[model samples]
Target: QVQSNGTALVAFEKATGKVRWAIGQELASYTSPLVVTMHGQKVLLYFARGGLLAVEPRQGKVLFHFPWRARIEESVNAANPVVVGSRVLLSECYGPGSVLLDIDQQWQPRVIWSDAGKDRWDRSLAAHWCTPIYVDGYLYACSGRETPEADLRCLDYNTGEVQWVQKRTGRCTLLFVDRHLLCLNEFGTLIVLKPNPQKYEEAARYEITDLEYPCWAPPVLSDGILYLRGRGRLVALELIPSRK
Candidate 1:
């Protein structure tokens, strides 16, 4: 959680909300820490304002730390590393774009690749917001570029090659719900599509314009119903028809 003094506190959770341990730093963190288990070992990955820190979960013992100083500007990697197999894919904005690291090694992390063509690598931007969805030897990223138009990019997971570029004139977000690929645009438009291998195809399209300002939050899909909120109003709609 982000503290008031622009510092961060890494707290360990115990039984019944009892504090097991925590680490406070001089700078706050906006990036969310990701916890994962590999080979029966649970580890906590934290990307703070200053740099990246890894710690053990049993007693909060720090494993190792490394500073990312690409530029002297205020920088912190917000794109939580996407872990696949023994590799972790991490992306950053502002001075850093994206980097792939190998986590199976016994020593510190090793960098595999980083893209240099993109100007600003803000993954949360229109063209960069799509989660790096991994598929048959490919990873997909959708974000807005200089023209504020959403662009769907299919990149090679290993080589980072541009497979295809599709200019989508809208905002987009992706999530998997009930075996369906859920996508939403900025203007309260929802599109359910399957992550097709050949191209993008929508399974269902619906609009939820509430006569309010633009939606700033991502929509949530639950059960067979979709829920969205704007301007202190909650709109819930039944997606698939339920059994009579």
Candidate 2:
């Protein structure tokens, strides 16, 4: 486990209570520490107010630390960092926008690109629980800062450029199946849109009969199954129609 005293980052072994490593730097944060493995090396990812920082797990050596000028409310990131191939996707809602970083052979970090549009729209940064998705050659994300308004957007993974934007969607909880983007609204309604660059084309949609308010959650798609939750209840749905 990793613990921060605000001025220092510390990692410990739970079972043996051994102190694996310790690094110091005060960062405002309400975000969680994420454990990741890159290039076969274990690393801990942390959003320490100033910016995103990556450190070696076993040795507790910081791989790279990039500083940004943006400030996050409560020092929180609504989403987690999505690692793809050689780069990591870092996004914040409040004006700092998003950045794509390339990790070098020496573990140094390089800024591939930046997007100011990724910042908070209506003001709240951590609006949704859904993290950014890097699938195919694009990154899928949702923004719903103003009202219950949401925008389902796609961006190029290698370029950090927006592929397309689908507007007028409510607070969207997102999922993917067979390369399709599946989403949910504040209600129990569902939407299916193609993650395309040319245009927005919806392939399918459905609504939950009695599923009511605060369906403000994202659906999970797995192995041809779809799971939804609302009003403290969980329901499983079939993604594909029955063979019979």
Candidate 3:
């Protein structure tokens, strides 16, 4: 279990709840750890306060460490690292907008490109906590630090070039499935849109008026039912029609 305030990461055995291994006296952001295979080796990445660390999952060995933190005092490393090929993309709204890193076979990280060097909105995708989903060489995401200024954006993932931006969707968390982007805004509104970098084509919208205000959790799709978390309740809605 990773501490909420970013101090220490503890791994536990599922059945017995025994502490398997605990590593680091490091600080972490609000984002969670991601396990992925890099350069043909399975490694765990923790975006900590000091930097990004690649650790051996089972034995708790630090393989490589990459320093990355927002320069602004109020800023944080909240977005989860998006792994592209042998590269990883990190972005935050407060500090540098976005940075692309190339990881070689030796597991060394080198910054290849950075969008934060430009303006905030000019970056690939400046997100608060909404992690952009990359598909078909493009990225679809909610870009901005606050709700009023947030925009639904599509960008070229490799070059950090903006394709299009739609301002109506306010600070959304999105999930991509079946070539469609399922976006859930902070207002608890669900919107379905086509995943296209050329333009924004919204298919439909469903608003949950009964739910309490500020639903920031990302919508979850399990089996055929869609789950939405509100103030204090869990809502389950069946998205697929029953076969009768």
Candidate 4:
């Protein structure tokens, strides 16, 4: 849970429901905290309103706090940090487009690449809320704050270089499963794509007629059933065809 001014993260005993540890004064963001292993230790990465805070999960000890949010007052740090080995990627649509950081042996962060001061159209990826799907050595995501300005893009993970862009994709979320990319846009359109770094390759597309606008929730897969939630309804599609 998060508070306005005081401690942000609080750990409670599951069986007894007692407070174990509380730490930090970082304000809340929509992004969820992620636990990753680095340097043979588990660290909790929380993208708060002020920046990224890395903490030791068990004792709530602060490891490193890196400021990486936008300057504007109305902006948000929505995307969850993407971690690949010792490198971490953070992105937002406000001003800081994306930044890749290398975590050293001492847990100190070093900036590898960033598109912070670039033009909006020239930035590699300005993800509004959806986190980029990292595949192979590339990142696939919808970049932009709104539906009209958004585009599906593929970028090189190391250099933050744009490889390809599929325009008019709208603000969409991506899920990779079974060697295919599943994209669910805000307008209730689901697109199946092939993960190709060289070009945009769409395999199939379908419109969920029952789902309305503002389908911001990512698609959920459980027991081979694909579930999509819209503004008013939830629809489940079974991926495996029924036996005759």
Best by TM-score: 4
What is the C-alpha lDDT profile of model 4 across 1-244, one tens digit per residue?
4444557677778998877788878777889989999989899998887788898999899989988878898888999999999899999888878999999989899999998788888888899899999999899988999889999999999999899999988899999999999999999999999999999999999999989988999998888889999998999999977667
Mind giving the per-residue lDDT tens digits that candidate 1 earns over 182-208? 666666777776666567666888777
Model 4 clash tally?
0
Deviation in angstroms for 12 in model 2? 4.5
lDDT of 2 by residue, 48-69 (tens): 6677778776777777887753
Colliding pairs, model 3: 6-28, 27-49
Report the number of clashing residue pairs per model: 10, 2, 2, 0
Which number leads on lDDT?
4
Better of 2 and 4 by lDDT: 4
Indicate the worst ten consecutive residues by lDDT in candidate 2: 119-128
TM-scores for the candidates:
0.76, 0.78, 0.89, 0.95
3 versus 4: better lDDT goes to? 4
Q: What's the lDDT for residue 193 in model 3?
A: 95
lDDT of 3 by residue, 20-49 (tens): 877776665788888998777888888766
Candidate 1 vs 2: which has more lDDT: 2
Full-model lDDT for every candidate? 0.59, 0.69, 0.80, 0.90
Model 1 regions more than 4 Å off: 1-9, 16-18, 24-26, 66-77, 116-130, 145-149, 211-213
Query: What is the lDDT, from 0 to 100, of the residue 9 in candidate 3?
Result: 65
Off by over 4 Å in 4: 1-3, 242-244
